[model samples]
Target: MKKINLNSEIEELNPEELDHIEQALLSRAQTISKLAYAPYSNFNVGAAVLLENGEVLQSSNQENVSYPVGTCAERILLGYAGANYPNSTPVMLAIVAQRAGEETWASVSPCGMCRQAINETENRYQRPITILILCANGNVLRVKGISALLPLKFDDLNS
Candidate 1:
C-alpha cells in the first residue's frame, strides 16, 4: 500500500475584493436565498452556477414535508443546469445561506451528496468549477475546484 497526502487551498476574501463575475454570482446566490422554501428548517440556502457560455443560473433550497425528500440549493442548481443547459459547462458556483430571523447570513458548505454532485459536474465538463462561498457577515471563501473541497472523491466502483 502507498501513502498519499491530499491538500487544498482556500482563499479568504472580502466582499469588496471580489471580481465582477464573482460579485454577480455571489450576489445572485444571496438574492435567491430569500426565495427558498425552507419552512421546516428555516435555513434558507441559495446557489448560482455560472456557465462557460456566460449564462448564470440560480436556485434555492426546496423543502418537503419529509425532510429526507428535500433537496439542497446546490443540487437544484445542478439539476436545472443539466436539464436546460446540457451542452454548456459550468465555470463557477456561488453559495450562500441565511437563517430565519437572523440579520446576518453564514457561509454554508455543500452537503456530502451535493459535493459529489459538484464533483460529477467537473468530471462531466472536464474542467474545474471555481467555488465562491459567501457569508452575510462579509466573509468570503474561494476554492479553485471541487477537488479542493473533496480530495478523495468517489469516481466509480472499480477503483
Candidate 2:
C-alpha cells in the first residue's frame, strides 16, 4: 500500500488585501444567492467562475419542483460557461452558500457530479481552476485547482 498525502492551501484575506477581481467574484456570488430558487431546502447557493479572457460568470442554484431535477450552483455556472464560452478555460471559481434567514455564510463543497464536470473542464482546458470560497464573515478559503478538491480522479486523459 502507498500513502498519498494531500494538502490544501487557503489564504485568509484581511479585507484590505482582497483583490479587486476576487472581491467582485465574491460580491457576485453573494448577490446571486438571493436569486436561488430553493423553496424546499431553503438553502441558497451561488457560484462565480472566472475565465482567462477576463470573463466572470455568476450563477445561482435553480431548484426544481420535482426535487431531483434541480441543479447546483456550480453546475449551473459550469454549464453556462460551456454553452456561452466553449473555448474559454475556467481560471477561478468562487462559491458562496447561505441558509434561509441566516445572516452568515457557510462553506459549500461541490457535489460528485460537479466534481466530474470540473474534472472534464480541467482536462479540456489542460489547466487548473483556482477556487476562492468565502464565509459571510469574510473568511476566504482558497484552493489552487479543481483537482485539489477531487482526488482519486478518473479520466480518459489520465488513463
Candidate 3:
C-alpha cells in the first residue's frame, strides 16, 4: 500500500502588511461586494484581478432565481479578463464577501468550480496567480496559486 499526503499553506497576515497594490485590490473587492446580486443567499461576494498589463478588473457575484444558474464573482472576473485581455496574465486575485446588511466582512473561499476555473486560467497563462482572501477578523489570507487550493485539479483533456 502507498500513502500520499497533500498540503496547502495559507499565510495569515495583518491587513496593514499588504502592499499598495494588494491593499487596493482588497479594497476594490470589498467595495464591489456591495453590488452583488445575492437576493437568494444574501451572501455577497466580490473578486478583483490584477493583470500583468497593469490593468485591474473587478466583478461581483450575480445570482439568479435558479441557484445553479448563478455565477461567482471569481468566474465572472476571469471570463472578462480572458475575453478582454487574452494575452495578459493574471498576476493576483483578491476576494471578499459580506452578508447583506451586515457591517462585518466574512471569511470566504472560492467554490470548487471557481477553483477549477482559476486553475485553468493559471495553466492557460503558464504562470501562478497569487490569491488574497479577506478574513472575517480584518486579516488577510494569502495563497500563492490555485494549485494550493485545488491540488487534484482537472487537467486539459486535449493535452
TM-score of each: 0.94, 0.89, 0.97
Between the candidate structures 2 and 3, which one is better when assessed by lDDT?
3
| lDDT of every predicted structure (CA atoms) | 0.92, 0.85, 0.95
Which runs of model 3 end up more than 4 angstroms from their true locations? none
Best candidate (score: TM-score): 3
Off by over 4 Å in 2: none
For model 2, name the residue pairs that clash: none
Report the number of clashing residue pairs per model: 0, 0, 0
Looking at model 2, report the run of 10 residues with the lowest lDDT sum. Answer: 7-16
Residue-wise lDDT of candidate 1 within 59-79, one digit each (tens)? 999999998999999998998
After the best TM-score superposition of candidate 3, give how far the Cα of residue 36 lies from its true spot, in angstroms: 0.4
Q: After superposition, how far is residue 51 of candidate 3 from its true place, in Å?
A: 0.5
- The weakest ten consecutive residues by lDDT in model 1 span 130-139
Order by TM-score, highest first: 3, 1, 2
Tens-digit lDDT track of model 2 for 66-134: 988999999989988988998888998988899999888876778888888888888888898878878
